[model samples]
Target chain A: MAHITVTVDGTSYKGEVEPRKLLVHWLREDIGRVGTVVGCDTSNCGACTVLLNGRSVKSCSVLAVQADGSEVTTIQGLSDGNEWHPVQTAFKECHGLQCGYCTPGMVMATVDLLSENPTPSEQEIREGLEGNLCRCTGYHNIVKSVSYAADLMSAGPTKGAK
Target chain B: MIPVEFDYVKVTTIDQAIAALKAGGEDSKIISGGQSLVPVLRLRMAEPSVLVDCGAIDEMLGVREDGGSITIGAATTHHAVMSNPLVQKHALLLAQATATVADPAIRHRGTTGGALAHADPAGDVPAAALALDASFTIAGPGGRRTVAAKDFFLDYFTTAVGPDEILVSFSIPKCDWGSHYAKFNRTAQAWAIVGVAAVVNVEGGVIKEARIGLTNMAPTAVRASTVEAALVGASSAADITAAAMHAADGTRATSDLHAKADYREHLARVITARAVRAASGI
Candidate 1:
């Protein structure tokens, strides 16, 4: 086993892990960040998406050793300890999820999309989140949530809606 | 879902990676972005005993412009290539096709070299690279060498890159060609059933030159040289449409659940016409 040091959600972790340990497993098993779910072990489903150095990546497709010395932010770390991030609030208010299985990955992917294109058209939002799939909701409400999140984020540093 | 047990070593230099490959022998597979290899490992399609991680190799990263050509490092992420000014200005086809790859998250992790080395006929980048006449530079124990992109892809899930060799970079000449990529997929993220990459150089209302590359219509990404030959000196959209009918002239397309060979041929012609029209700015 090789030792790897990584900073997840703002906490630095050092552990001896096997080479084959996937990042999604490492996040849930080793670091106790169960918020990042693995809907499909194949890269097709994006339920395990997270931010690696501020860019979204499917954690299920990434090995823990590959993330060595990198900073990873999962759905659990999106907000300051107390309140939900704007994207999170937007999802809740807009009813963006039904089963919530794909929520964490979808929300994280949106954080990436909005940061890249602060004001995207509905088509652009749909295209941006194409990698993340949802069986419930048919993506209509999820698109609305992203639109709402964009508006909330555009309103400046106010805390997300309650 | 979990990959079988394997030994892993992360390397910081080209030589170190080469040495690791040599020591680990044939069972060792090089992992750059892990966007492709990891999935295969998870599915148990490959059982490599060791994985040499080359993600930290700084030498094999970024884009460099030299005189009339740009050399993209093998490890350069798709996101980096998509956003690079040099690629946008000179190789816009690459940038345009890259934007359509997997998605933002996969783009963040997949590398140009990895995609080319994977050599999947359904991938968009290989056809784009072929239309641009890109050259791949490789390094192995015997030293370094270069191979034309046309000769790089040997078969399905195979490449000219030997197990002991690493694809170092890809270089393409600067040209005044306007290009377009036309891809057809059932879903937003599905692989192309049949795709076409077209590059056109027009002067004085006549086609000065044209290069057409067809993807997933053959065992390897093959050039629509017949269509290209028929398009030279042609000006009208009708002329382009006529020439594009030959898009599948020499191809050996297959019949699959996604699309039948005949349907793929029909789509090839239609998409080639569309790509050529957009590329010629007509």
Candidate 2:
């Protein structure tokens, strides 16, 4: 076992992890950050997407040891107290999800996408979220949510949350 | 799916990585980015006794200019490769192809050397490396050696890199030619069904020279020498179309769930023509 120090959300967690342990398993099973759900164990689905060192990466594809000195931001850490993040607010306002199984990943991916491209066209938004898959809502509302989220983020500080 | 338990050693230098690999024996595997290796590990396809994590090797991490070529560290992620100004200016084909690899998340974590060393025939980068005439530098206990991209891939999921050697970097020559990578995939994140990488030098509206690489056309990435030969001095769209007919001349394409052998051959012809046309600005 290798000892590692990983800062998740905002808290630093120090522990011993097996070399074979995936970052997603360690986050959910070990630390109870179940907000980052695992859809397809394979890397195809982006349900396990999280920000690693300020860039998005699939947690399932990353070994826990690889993230020893890194900071990871999952969906659980997006909001501040009772106020939701701009992305979470946009998803709720635009009805971006139906079953909501893929919402956490979708919302996290949107945060990363908007960070990279603040103003994306419809085609660019679709292309940016290509890794994420949603079996419900046909992705029309999800794309709308991303566009709305972009508007909310660029409008200075976020307003009162619902 | 949990991978089998294994010992992990993280090394920050190439020499230290080599020592770890040598000590771990032949069953030891190197992990960089872990985009491809982790998936295989979870599937239980590869059960290495030791996983030497070389992702933190500082010396093997960025892009630099070496004389007339750009030497990219093997551990450079695909996102970095696509966005690096040096690579974008010198090896645009590589940037274009790297941009099409999986999605944004995968690109952020997948390394150029990891993809090249993995050597999946359906992968997008190997063909781009071949078209750009990239050379791989590998480091072993006996020191370092460079292998041409053409001779690097030996078979399916195999390369000239020995088990005990670590791929250090790739040197791609700078070219003042038009290039394009035309990939056909069922989905945005899916592997290429049949892809073509074309680099063409047009002089006075006539093709002066051309290099073409085929993906998923054989056990390994192969050059379309016949099509390249046929494209010289071609000045029209019809000329490129006619030349692309020989795309599958000596390829050993296989039938898979994505496409039949014959269909892949047909795609090779059609996509090669499109790639050449776009590359030469015809």
Candidate 3:
């Protein structure tokens, strides 16, 4: 076992984890951030998405040890704790999610996307969130949510925080 | 599934990383970015005794233009390649193909050297490297040496890089060549069923020079010699398309559920033509 410290959700965490423990397992097991789901242990599915150093990455594919000195933001980290992030708000208003299994990852990936492109075109939205998969909604609603989030984010801080 | 337990050493320097690889020897795996190798490990397709992490080697992470060539560090991410102006100015074919690689997340983490070293037959980088005539700079205890991209790839998932040697960087000569990449993929993030990269130089309405590299049509990324030969004097779209029909002439392709061999061959021909037309501007 190796002892490592990770900064997750803006909080410092110290734990003793095995060398092979994946970041997804660490997120759920050690950190108790169960909102992050691991749809496919392999990378083909993007269900276990998270923001590492301000970029989205499939958490399951990364070993916990690899994130030793990195900052990770899971789905649980999105809001300022009072409300949903812009992506979550847009996802809800646009009816972008159903069953909600892939929502957390979709929301996180969308947050990363919209921050990079505040006013993404419809096609650009689709292309930006291509790494994320939302089978429950057939991606129609998810794309809508991303588009809505882009609009809301373009409107500035008012729409997202509320 | 979780991977088997193994010693993991995240080295912070290129020399340290290379030393770890040397100590671990043949059973060691040098991992950077881990976009491609991680999945393989989770699936248990490969079992290495040690993983020498090269992600922390900051020296291997950036792009710059020196003299007449654009040099990109081995650890530089695909996103960096796409965003860097030096790469855009000198190797636009590389930039465009880098954009088409796996999607945003993978692009954010995947490294240029890792992709080239993986050398998947369906990958876009090898073909792009071939099109640009890039050279790889590898380092080991013996110091540094450069190998032509054509000779760098030995076979499927294999390269001239030995276990002890680290792929330090890649250097691509700057050119005024017109370049383009055309790929046929099943989805937004799926591997290319077939991809083509073309670089052309047209002089006075006739073809002065042309180079074509094909993906998913052979064991390794191979050049379309027949197409190159046939398009030498032909300046018309129809003639180039006819020449591109021979794109898959020299290789054996494996068929899978995504696409059959015959269909892939057809895609190679069609994509090659489109790439040539766009690149050669005819």
State the lDDT at A123 in candidate 1: 98
lDDT of 3 at B150: 88
Q: What tens-digit string does per-residue lDDT give for candidate 3 at A45-119?
A: 788989989999888878898888889999888887787788888988989988888888888888888778888
In the range B189-216, model 3's lDDT, one tens digit per residue, is 9889999999888887677788888888
Which 10-residue span in candidate 1 chain B carries the lowest summed lDDT?
A: B169-178
Candidate 2 chain B least-lDDT 10 residues: B51-60
Each predicted complex: what DockQ? 0.89, 0.93, 0.82
The C-alpha interface RMSD of every prediction is: 0.7, 0.6, 1.0
| Residue lDDT tens for model 1, B65-119 | 9788999998999999999999999999998888888888999999987898888
* Model 2 steric clash pairs: none
What TM-score fits each model?
0.99, 0.99, 0.97
Highest-lDDT candidate: 2
| Candidate 3 C-alpha error for residue A101, in Å | 0.9
Model 3 per-residue lDDT at B159: 85
Instruction: Considering the two chains of model 3, state its CAPRI-style docking category.
Output: high
Off by over 4 Å in 3: none
lDDT of 3 at B151: 97
